[model samples]
Target: MANYIHVPDEAPAVPKIDVTVDERDYRSGALKLIKELRPSWKPSEVKVKFFTDGITNKLLGCYVGAVMQDVVLVRIYGNKTELLVDRENEVKSFRVLHAHRCAPRLYCTFNNGLCYEFLQGTALEPEHIRSQPVFRLIARQLAKYHAIHAHNGWVPQSDLWLKMGKYFALIPKYLKDPEQNTRLSTEVPSPQCLREELVWLQQSLSVLGSPVVLCHNDLLCKNIIYNQGAGNVKFIDYEYAGYNYQAYDIGNHFNEFAGLNEVDYSHYPDRAFQLQWLSSYLEAYKEHKGQGSEVTDGEVEVLYVQVNRFALASHFFWGLWALIQAKFSTIDFDFLG
Candidate 1:
């Protein structure tokens, strides 16, 4: 039987005190929340911590001796848990309902907006991921996630084009201004080009007739962890997970393939890599649905264009946000640049 850490006799007590809305105090709150949440597990036992600390938010990872020693990831923020409880519950329900199709696990939301979960298996590094095989696996998994019958319960009412519009608005503010552009990038998109691309994306997304799915919009190599025994992959960090274009998930994974280091791409030419990846993914997706193709060749072509367009859109949206936070706060902007 796998070792399980029992809850301690007494939960660790965190002082009941609040501080001003500052980053230092936020860290303190996160530390305090961790103690309160895992009163049973010793802080020292947690290992292999990975997180990005900045103005956006904080995530902490540590190991607990559970089911072959699993990972406990905690995310902290200032918002009350009530605000997120519904979303978290929705996510949990989505996961549980799809347990046969994805990783099965337990999740808890602690005070101070800290959410933690015990996930099984080792996360895959960019170098270790077998591009063709894993790409196929991810595609099938996404199809399953999108197929769940959630009706109107959790789907975000806002349309995809509206979301793209918000992204379009930020490009100029980040790229045109001397200070902001210097802080973010040296080159700004020409006004004409930006306008044209925005129109193109709006039209493209409008005709995408596929139903929305629970998308892991951020499918960077780091988010996927390999499970050798199951011969499959699991995903984490569902913060960006929500109802969106099914094709968006495919595009995101394809983007990851394109962004690989020169060494990996050398092994597989870009076109060959995409073809193998898509073929495998589509095959698995077709098997799961046990029906005709859920996506078509024409749709895939549109997705390819959107992937590049979204890449540029994300560069500006996240870039400007980082630049503003860095200027307003003490955080570093190197990663943003």
Candidate 2:
């Protein structure tokens, strides 16, 4: 087995593009964000470009003033995300994670928007997650993330089951309008089946007695920024970060390893792979949190089973999240798939 090693390098100078925001009404928010971020720069000197990958927010990449200048990510919450997300609590989570460097830095925030220091590097792909070295590095980062507690305020979902129940309850509202979502209406499991499964899952998982820790509920690869230059990964998008079962967090990430948009389950890690990966994560998590004991083989085996079962919760969480987004969000992504 290869040992995961760190070789840190100075983060390269953040590239700066110099261009002007087009004078249009739709451009107002982006322009406003730039002026708020760097009041010294004029609109004509700032370049406002839309980032195309977001599913839950309007992402804008803004370059203010000149090249070599720092970049900031401007996020406008999607149309109805506020109904499901408490921005105030989300902001507090960001502060705690950023303060310790587990997540990105928050430059500024407003009623419905935020300006974040742009993290350099590509988001990890499924292939990258499959790489042993990259996989181990991410495990360490996630372990570090799980150990974080919201120091400035209350963390959401100390009650994970109730939280998911709330999401499941939204199904009716989402399905009410005939046009709520043409595709998802046909794709999502019936409300009855979903509920029964939820109840059973909660009952079954209760036996594990998993620790309740802060989790990045949305562990999609896109939310993870890999900075090869720094020899580590940095988490972004704290909209769903909060307290939840430790097994659920690891399980959710493994589920995401299945990939997005055609979601091939074949890529999901096998038993042997899960054992190796989960063992590394558990050990690294303990080490980072200063637990001196080694994780036992029996414990790793139990966690492997636990995480695989918890993977079902991850599918349901995102499926419901997409249902809500399908009803209201205007972002371009295959929500039903």
Candidate 3:
């Protein structure tokens, strides 16, 4: 196994993308968007701070100055992310989640980015993810998200392999030449090699019986907010959200336990621990659906194993994504780190 190193909780350094907006522009944009969101709010009174967790978005933290503060996040989508994300679908996901209060309220979406309410909560750390309560909270939220019928009434992308195929096709076009690429280690697999692995993964997971649902395709820890006062968690960053295999969502989430920046694979959850966590998720899922019948251990056990297998898909998805980002993205973070 490749050795994993620990990194600090600091957000990765801002990358060198040729952005259309700057700090002043982001603050100005936030002021404009928020004024539109709350017509009574004066733009002159609005204060915008920089939200640092963003990798692919230029995020400014905006608040209406007051004792009862109304804070919202203004995200300016980075240049070239259009090469990867389906922005229309993302807008749809945010609208639905906003209605349910499971996500930040969508204030407005512009051609370049969007404005949304920023919740009061801390993002769970890598250590926090290993906690049972935190894991269960996220798992149940995933189940609830899976059950939601999009207001837009779109078709489900329950299969991730198809998306993988699409992203893979974009690889050569986006990947920078080897000489220009410094973020990736030499051990990073070639696109052809990664394709072979994805093919095998697709075939291997074809028999899993997990049902399709609308999914938050990307469930990284940084995207989840834990509201202690409400004792609830809300998911953010709908840019990559869509329908996919239920197992893939759970599996991908488990994979995120390692956290970003450090990318510590050693922290990946084990089978028994995974099952315990999954049981809570299934129980909550049944409860959400108003099913009184008990969920069988057998059912939970099956999902546990399948999610582990599906974990391979998560690695490949981001590996391909990082390779493309290394070449195409101008925001200068350590994509390989």
Each candidate's number of clashing pairs is 1, 0, 7
Of candidates 3 and 1, the better by TM-score: 3
TM-score of each: 0.65, 0.85, 0.85
Across residues 254-281, which tens digit of lDDT does each residue of candidate 1 receive?
5454343332434322655555555556
Model 3 segments more than 4 A misplaced = 1-24, 66-68, 149-159, 173-185
Better of 1 and 2 by lDDT: 2
- lDDT per residue, candidate 2, 1-337, as tens digits? 1111111233222222232333234376667666666788778877767776677777777785556347777777777788677676577667667666776767777556777888888888888887868888888888888766443434434456867787776754444446535545576677888889888988998777777777777888888888788888877898877777888988998888878876898888889888888777888888877896499999898888888888888887777777766666666675655
How well does candidate 2 match the true structure in TM-score terms? 0.85
The 10 consecutive residues of candidate 2 with the worst lDDT sum are 1-10
What are the Cα lDDT values of the candidates? Answer: 0.51, 0.73, 0.73
